[model samples]
Target: MTLRHAAFAAAAAMLLMGPAHAAELEKLWEIDGLKQPESALYDASGGVIFVSEVVGDMRAKDGDGQISKVSPEGKVVQSGWVKGLNAPKGLGLSGGKLYAADIDELVEIDVASGKVTARHKVEGAVFLNDIVTDGAGRVYVSDSGTNTISVLESGEVKPWLRNDRLNSPNGLAIEGDAMVVASFGKPAAAGQEAVPGFLVEAPLSGDSVRTLGDGSPIGALDGLVVLGGGKYLATDYIKGGLLRIDQSGSFETLAPLPSGTADLSYDPQTKTAFVPQNKEGKLTAFRIP
Candidate 1:
């Protein structure tokens, strides 16, 4: 049965370590009306949250996709659907514009117009995953297929950086001039479902695209968000837990999510972390202290 309303999906209280706040993390809403919820972000104006539904099937990846908005009152609604998309993931909203990363492309939705305003086909994007936007209007996208990250310049694809040190870079965030990345150190491919996660840092400079070799410790890092005061929260898919990383490169587990947490983002103004469960088709909301 479809849940009439979305509620908190919380597990048992956890014994946190290393000065971490143990505020209860709960499942805010379960997306029944969609298929394969992969990534989530907030709509600043309407007090709603948008989640990407990636349709993957038995023999092939269906790739027909959509975005659902959950209102402040815990109601789920279909906000927009992108045509010719292949599995949308990693989402961001800036200046009232919503940008999403699908399996092979990037889509921009004009919330005011309620139409697909722009679409960029990522060149050689095997798994276009997470995206982050600098408030100044610069957008960064992660392409896990080629172990690379790209940026959109004037609506055209530009090679940001490609490094073999990073593999399956799924989630992205911007901290000052540094590009914070969370990824599993393996190429995201069929038949290899077992790989631990890695959280690494790289300066945003395209020429100096070198891994810092130091970042938040994670397990199959899937999604990531940056919080106020230089802290990070990530979805660890391999260990099935949420990880908290501090500025000093120190980290610990916050809470254990279900088997399939695909993406996450934070609203610094509200201090709330938005989490998406891809396989279970659920969305979780957490208050990180």
Candidate 2:
């Protein structure tokens, strides 16, 4: 056989194997002794990582939450880089500012000064979980309690989308003109058990929100990161694992983590993923294929 033919055959074999057998997470390092770290954000230009720590209860307005700064090498640069927050969960960076989902408000901090400049209140927000920013610098946050996604733009915070179909959205990611949501699934109703969550795609310009694939349950999903080529990496908050979900909504567990694997951050350029193990009080870094 010709060399080109052999290469094509090998590639076809890998495609047939699917992501389930092809993807594996290699552990790089872990930083322990965190205070219920819930989310991580990697700043490529700044060469650092930011972690939100819920020092106390997850739902309490105790004002003990803090953000930590860590080096790429797993060293804690500053344990309390920013404080005076009430259970901050998600972190996003844009326009030299850092935005965090703090319970019911969007907290904005100057990345250079590490000072919180503003806190935009979401009127009906119950438990704000994840935050993401688009290329235009507009910020979007998910309220898991209210099943809503709110947006902050032009100096105003308002509800962008609210629907029961969100099913307790916990993570947010921007993909072109659509927003990919990691649902935590709806809480159990009377005489009914809780339902496992699934990936949802909501159009940014329309009201159509639909399940990604066949409406099948994946897990109580949390963090969501777009890996391009119609692929995503998500963390299951309840099941405690990393998942590789395709555009068709089919998924395979990539890593079996501990419970409370909350909002994770992926640096595509470096091919690294940072996971905040909320229950274990640790931040782990893994090299991804």
lDDT of each: 0.72, 0.92
Whose TM-score is greatest here? 2
Estimated TM-score for each candidate:
0.81, 0.91
Model 1, 1-289: lDDT tens digits are 2343322222122322234645665545444545777887776666777777777741134646777777643567655445445677888776667888876677888877657788888888777888898867777899877888988867778779888666678788887888888876653468765556566778878555445346433577888888757678888765567788766667777777777777876677767777777767667676776
Cα displacement (angstroms), candidate 2, residue 159, comes to 0.8
| Regions of candidate 2 where Cα sits further than 4 Å from its true position | 1-23, 188-191
lDDT by residue (tens digit), candidate 2, 154-256 = 8799899999899999989999989999999966689998799998989997487988888899999999999999999999988799888998889988789
Model 2 residue 216 lDDT score: 90
Q: Which consecutive 10 residues in model 2 have the weakest lDDT in total?
A: 17-26
